[model samples]
Target: MLNFFLVNRLSSQVRILSSLLVMLLVFILVTVLVKVDTSTWTMEFFALSLVCVAILSGASNVLTASVFGVTGRFPLQHSQSLISGQAMGGTVSALAAILDLTIASNVTDSALAYFLTADVFILLCIAAYLLLPKITYSRFFGLFSYYMNLPDEPTDSSSSEDPVETVDVSSSKTNSPPIIPILKKVKVLAACLFYTFFISIIIFPTISAGIESVEKYTGSIWTNKYFTPLTCFLVYNFADWSGRQITTWIQVPGPNSKMLPVLVFLRTFFIPLFMFCNYQPRKHMYEVFFKSDIYPIIFITLLGMSNGYLGTLSMVYGPKVVPKELSEGTAIVMSFFLGLGLAIGSAFSSVVHLI
Candidate 1:
């Protein structure tokens, strides 16, 4: 909706710059949250912070996609970079949490350390964005500039030879709404994205957070204490990063293949499967199937890898399916759908206890 309103009024570069400002604001907010005593904070402050993060995240997605779309030359590799960055973020957060558990004296110290690390990364992003347009190669391709000169596609003279074809082309151009056409073109991509995140978000962070190794297992105490979280978050991040990296080598079963959505939908099994995997809530009712800690480790690794692989495929392929002029808007729309999947999946995760 922001894109609908602001795409015409502001250049993509300006919108992206505005998103950077929003990110900086978020980092500042995190800093304040960390520095201020927890006793002074209330639910309202935390709620407001969440609201701010959601809005800024959506804005950033729109602006980034807009820049890619408007530039016309940015390719799937660029989209891959964005997806890889997201995976990297999870990997970093996981490492930070591990460090916090191992080294931090208290929860407060851990929070402070995590927030400071995040702030530094946010600053680095701001610096990179600031310098992007100043460098010639980045200016030409990385940053979207209204004045960037691009060669126009050569018109086909054969269309002029046939009056019916010319009239059909003109009429089609006149009657179609720009966004609607692109949306139709990339409908499968949107659905693929929705399912990918829906399956992932439903099981991860919520359901996965509850799973633990059986007490009867003879693994080390640290492994028993931290194994679930490690498998759910840290191992997941590493496996996810590996899955995303694999795409760079092979993009098998290209975007148009019917099998992609099936693969995504099949991932729904992980929810129930993870739920049954020595989960704390149901440990009494269902006997632990696999006594060894290795079962969940293997499952989560596969889950994370699938999430990264399918997600990267959807992100990179979605834009390529659309015309270059519409790719940016299409990418943003894809992001919106991806967020929708997460929203729906999160909502479902909240209610899984009723099941």
Candidate 2:
């Protein structure tokens, strides 16, 4: 999709148009889903709706890649801010889900509230996006213009004196397949991103939801009802948000930094470790060493922090290693790799039940 846009000189509108379309799609889908009674909705239809939502979610990630790609050219700070904001967005959504689940009268109301809230937020995002171009001297407009003006390819140093020679060299390079060089340049960053999201997405939502505070750790009725999910959600998201913010002050694993991939891959240990916890489905299978609330909370916090820090490090550092013209592509590719990780991790989660 982006290649088509770039080839036709439509790159300038890629992010805005895609994001606007997605927001609108989300609004309509949520509204329709809310209106239909789940009791009457067939299992197949529900599954179809989930598939549509997943497609739209992937589209949203593409838009995020576009935005991040643009920001990558400016400075590391801009990329860090983009990632921190994403973490904050997750934290907010998790809080909303928690509130709906705990306070609503029943599951139906909770489901309705969640969809309604999502629709409202999408509407607001659309409104804000519409207002962006109208604001004079807006950073959004400035960034768009900056990206629009960037050369499609880096200028050769010899081009000023011999344009023909430059063209010939570029044509030869293109003939050999241009993507290979880019893949080589960004291998480390892409690997880091892949491993980062792969580790987190596999354990979260599915596996983490299975784990619980042991029977002995229960406090009150509320704790019995929502303590495990709520505590885990808050601890993980708060830790993620905090770790991202920390990057604003502390910079390590800068662009092309070797430690980033190492740190990210190390998180694979989380899978087996989490699986051995007192997960609701498999409590009888293991000794459940992490039975206390403190144990999982501490580990989850670390997991979240590592996810935020290392993921941010990869994005911020990726563009710096490539030529200025290729920076946007590099960032976009990294985002795509992250999505790949998520897909693989989600697939892996499906098999967790068998264990």
Candidate 3:
């Protein structure tokens, strides 16, 4: 049974193959765009391109989560899987930030960053291929079939002659409720939509504003130099806390749990801090008072900390509240909100610059 579990736990080669195909499709699409129409591409094109990329990305994540959830070891071994995924995600985000910063610093070109991102993704595929040699797909499939066939809850029987009766009663009770309640599903869906809107209306604009401010004030377009990797680290920590807190709240066997509320409170405190830190004191004073202004380093630091906290909570708990089956769908919705926010914010910034 242990061996079977281990075998099934390994990610399938078919998944890796599918991911590779998706990557190839993305690469081809990008290559075609670059080669055929260089000057004609616009922000709308970029937005559409991102939407496709996001859909593929969301599909990949959903596949991974489905595999993990199938193992039925959530909040234990599954927690580790979730952490690994988040860590990898954070690492990729940090790399992207570094590349952006490096391009801004003139140490590398923007094309180089793009190339590196593609290359790294290819390398990940190769790594997956190499790792696949140790695990047999046949064994995994067999294990998966076996596990799926097993009853979810054990039978409770007092007599040896009534095995079929026992199984019938057990199955009836076990199957009485759907895995998720309809009300819970509605709540989760509503929460996901609310979060998506919140990101669009609040988070992305704030980020874009901060980036623009950093570029104007620091005379550098590399916003990551001032924020990215640092924010990523802080955000990941917050995500970690949020994931654990939500999992604990949901899975705890008792009624007197205080973990969920505490986690929420911590998450709330970070948002204001982020806003205050990125308040652009110098610009406000210069425009209003028409004088040399002082930058509040402490305020900025607090803002960074707050941003981290908010980011972590949103990323972690946001998905937790979402139905497991709809995690990928929720992520796609979130991505849509992010894209919308970025577009609005960027347009607003451009308008402000024009004025």
Candidate 4:
């Protein structure tokens, strides 16, 4: 919520640049923190890490809104690519985590090196953002987005002059944006985005993390130590990325069609399917209907892929639902609802645990 407020009041460039800087700072902090033997400072280490993570997450929320607001101005493909790239980043991070766990002998040093490497990339992003104005592609869209924010002019039935040429330069000061109507225009898609992530947050890492391999009788390391990471993290992340990529080729349940929300709401069924898996230590639901590893592998893949595909469609459709002039505000509002979904779903998870 704080991040949402900041994005509303701050300039786009300022929000994005600050987020990148915060990311860089986090990388540095984590890099240095890992070097110390955390055994001695366990409480302090974890406490500080939590604080950093909270701050970084806020920055990330701001960045999401900023990306949507900026890309909402351009052609549809740009927004689609932005979402795909985010999924790709998650895939890379998952791969890196697995590699670090399996091969790195010195966990501390390897993790530190990982942060350092990430910092270098953050630096590159900062430089690229700084240079964005110099690039014609970006400058063109930046100006175009500015032009989009102008208020609608009075229609003149008889005036034959080019409308673009007659835009009053001072009109921006006279007209205030209609936030309520803009939000109303996008409320349906905003609901789609919210419920999409809501279902995702409720299932993942909560019910999904509890799911275990049924092949535990073998006592193999693959079924024990690596099963969750491989089946849960790698499979889900890759599938999610693949789903985002699939949108480039095929986007079904078109933006405004009723089919979109129908498909999104259908994902709720996955929760029960997961609950009946080989999830250990169930207090309330004891029946393990799905005993084979295959069920979870399939379910998680579906969960991740559906999330990617449906969520992206909602986001891409948000800014376009309203007039071009209101696109940026609409995009930011979509991001807020996305955050709201994740928040409510997270709270609901504890209720699920009690049940």
TM-score leader: 4
lDDT of 1 by residue, 21-133 (tens): 77778767877776676566688777877897887777667656665454334656766766777798889888877777767787776776676776687678668766766
TM-score of 3: 0.49
- Where model 1 places Cα greater than 4 Å from the true spot, the runs are 38-44, 51-72, 139-177, 216-220, 283-287
lDDT of 2 by residue, 228-346 (tens): 65767877888888888888888786665677767787899998888777777773466787766666777788889988888777767777776555666667777778888989989
**Candidate topping lDDT:** 4
Residue 141 CA displacement from its true place in model 2, Å: 9.8
What's each prediction's TM-score? 0.84, 0.82, 0.49, 0.88
lDDT of 4: 0.79
Q: Which residue pairs show collisions in model 3?
A: 239-312
- The sequence of per-residue lDDT tens digits that candidate 4 reaches over residues 1-355 is 4544554346677778989899889889888877777898789888998999898888888888886787887888888898988888988888888888888899678878888998898899899777766768865666433433433443443453433223342344334345567666677788999999999888887878778888987999989888988888888888888887787778788877899989989999988898899886688897899889999999999999999999988988888766555566678888889899999999987777654
What is the C-alpha local distance difference test score of each model? 0.71, 0.70, 0.40, 0.79
What lDDT is obtained when candidate 1 is compared to the true structure? 0.71
Worst 10 residues of 4 by lDDT: 162-171
Worst 10 residues of 3 by lDDT: 288-297
